[model samples]
Target chain A: MPVEKLIFYAFAALMLFAAVRVISVRNSVQAVLFLVLTFFCAAVLWMLAEAEFLAITLVLVYVGAVMVLFLFVVMMLDVDYAAMREGFARLLPFGIIVSLMFFGVLFYILRDRFFGPENLPPPPPHGADYSNVEALGEVLYTEYFYPFEIAAVLLLVAMVAAISLTFRGRQQRKGQQVSRQLQAQKSDRLKIVTMASESPRKATPEPAPTDPEEGQS
Target chain B: MDALLAVLLIIGKILLILIPLILAVAYTTFAERKLIGYMQMRIGPNRVGIRGWLQPIADVIKLLLKEIVIPSGASKGLFVIAPILFIAPSFAAWAVVPFDAGVVLADVNVGLLYLLAMTSIGVYGVIIAGWASNSKYAFLGSLRSAAQIISYEIAMGFALVAVLMAGGSMNLGEIVEAQSGGIWHWFFLPLLPILVVYWVSGVAETNRAPFDLPEGESEIVAGFHVEYAGMAFALFFLAEYANMILISVLTALFFFGGWLNPLQGIPGLETITAWIPGTIWLLLKAGFFLFLMIWLRATFPRYRYDQVMRLGWKIFIPVTLVWLFVLTLMIKGGLPPWFGEAG
Candidate 1:
């Protein structure tokens, strides 16, 4: 086998291990990290397959933005490991059966190409100078334009809905409106109050618990 | 056998790039101190070596000799890996940075995206470090860093899209080459506002001062790397400074025309400008940006956390989005001067 094939196999094995670890890991944070590893290895595989744009996008989007948020949320969650582990055995058979069934379906789809002579030959490879990004862009904008536009619209709707649902103001805590905070000029907060100077006269001569010198402050 | 030799050659090339990068980071720390010191009316780092030249080396040795104290409650594995993860992408992003014409490790077509991708990976280090530290300060710092990066990346991406639109290429080399005629032909001339947005976003993305909420020493105390000690802390320090330099280099590349002299036209001046090497021009531009960073730190007060958020999401996103739309219209309209290079 060529060195290329060796690298491919290494990536594949790493990806598989990471994917497994994603579910198998006891710690949620650990699980998410493993998932990131899975995404990273998958990106490398995509690189091997010569889909540089998609591969970089995978790293940029999934491993970068998405997983950071995932880790953020998972860390905030207070998980009871012992309680989670107690249910693991009960869920094992179901998990195994479901995964097995899914794999079986995948095998069923791929069996013809994998077992027999390659019925579907690989697509013609693009030249080194061919921009994967440009090709993908052309397809996304031209051929699948409608679906792409719809998907974009759907994401926009989801984003708006998420914001509206979660970002509404509540009366309980005096929430910091960042805009209000930022817009406030120093003049608004820092008032140079003019008053007559009194000779050591306290506003309230209440007895202090600790030090009498505190009243001067 | 040929492949083996090729791998060895590539490794050597990688080392060539990395050594300079490591040295750059070392000296950047020194420069930041000295520059800021000059601004603050204080003499900086004249002790270690001549004009504090060996301060970075001394700092490194000190950090190396210092004991790494892992917090008892901290997650061991992630704690160990966080600094490595944080620092790796800072170096890795340099692979696609075109120092001069045809001078890059991997001349991938999606070079810009590759840089973006690698830089994006920098957050993982902070997040992991914060998480593994098991300290509130670290966690808060990580969250802040993550949120800040994610929010700013959008504006930065849109700003870059404008650059791509103008340059008509995603490749860094081509982007620089496209702005070939002169400083006036540069993308920054056309996409000035977008460049500003991108620069600000870059500052925020790198977690620099005025937007350095992630490392709020007054409150969170070193932020994400709160629990890190010895070389781990050093790694984070290195990564931060590396990222600063990366941003500076990128600013030089994307907007200022990488490695290209400012004066391309106007007879008699061309002789003066042309003599300066392209690589030197690039370094000078990058250095200026680096100096600007230090200047900003000295000049501006650190922005409040919410203020930083407001600046990013509220102020910048809207500005960049509107600018992006305007550019798109210009391209469609075939407007001259406005829609010149990209359109």
Candidate 2:
């Protein structure tokens, strides 16, 4: 078999295994881990498809950041594994029927395409030394530049919205003023005032317990 | 048939080179300790062998003889596999590294990319090790390491991009050849900022001080390898040193003119002989940088985690980006003839 075919098979096998385990596993944490494995297998398949940049981005963005945050949430939550397992039989028949219907319809709709003849010719060799990253960059920046900028603006807006949502007004804590902090000077608190020396106090009064009950005791 | 036999013969030759290289890695620990000990005003491992020459061998034997202890509640399969995952890449990378002219085991076109891929794969070992141990400290250490490696890798990538721009190639041998003619022709002088950023990023990437927050001995308790014992710990140790050596070799290749004589135009030296092998020059340059790594490790304190991240992203990344643009301009205009070379 060719290397690409071999890689495809390997990734497909891993994806299948992880997908099965995602449903079969009793533990939710393990299911999430299986999901992560499925993502990883998909990434590997992307790599085998000559999408090097995409493959790495998938690993970095999804595996490195997304799955980590997922793991963090999973670890932090007080998940009731036993309770989650209950009512499974009650839900199974309906779940199976719905899943089968979805899968059957999806498969039926796509079967002709899946087993179809090679209608399209192989893409042109994309010029000598041209890479997918460069090609994508050229297309994104040239023809779709306005849309790209719009998408970026959308993302920026979303990011700001997210931050503002988290930024609540907490009155109790002391908030820092950047300008004041930066401009702080020692002279602001210091004073070299001259004063006449006073005589030391001869005696200091000591107070006893203030309550009349203490005096009676 | 002759071609096939020659290929087999070449394979045999590579194995011959590799066996000694592996042995050298073992002894590099001894060399590192002895050198560092001398620097720190102490005698290291005098009893291990005669004058401690065989200390690494003795240490290897000791580690081998020691019991492999898997902690209770640890994921046994993953825990056992982690060491192999860590060390395999360290050894595998030697295939692409050129010891001399046409002397590398594998001279693939995408050598640098292969190295990068291998290094990235190395993170899985740490992550798996941390998760398998079932200890919070180990897990936290691994997480920190994962984050550290990923963050610094970006900075490192930028630095390499500058070098790549200067050389116009990702092939390691081609990069080295482009630095030929003299030390001044090397990218380090023209691209000094990139060189500095690369070195700093390399230090962070390998988890060496003062960037070694992951394995801050006082804090994370040896980081991801906390639960590993005997041979397992040795594997992590070997991986760290191997990474250090790898980065040093890379620095030499990118900046210091790998396999090129620095003393190119010295009057009497030029007259004496020109028959010296290029690999010696490369090894010496790489060795000097390795020593510097150890010196920095001995002298510097580990940075706080936040500080490490800040330096990588907020400082190194910007500096590298600016210099990368500068380098691109210089290469486009063609730098002065004697820029990196100084007699």
- DockQ winner among the candidates? 1
Residue pairs in collision within model 1: none
lDDT of 2 at B276: 80
The lDDT per prediction is 0.89, 0.78
Shift of residue B291 alpha carbon in model 1, Å: 0.5
The list of candidate 2 runs beyond 4 A from truth reads A1-11, A26-78, A83-117, A120-162, A168-217, B1-18, B105-110, B264-274, B337-343
Compose the digit string of candidate 1's lDDT tens values, residues A1-217: 3987999999999999999998888789999999999999999999888888889999999998888888888988988888767887889899999999999999998787665557766568888799888888998999999999999999999999999999868558877776676799999889898886754556545575477576456
TM-scores of the models, in the given order?
0.91, 0.78
Per-candidate DockQ values are 0.76, 0.11
TM-score, chain A only, candidate 2, equals 0.70
Candidate 2: what lDDT? Answer: 0.78
Interface root-mean-square deviation, each candidate: 0.7, 4.0
Stretches of candidate 1 off by over 4 Å are A88-93, A113-117, A167-217, B335-343
How does model 1 score by TM-score?
0.91
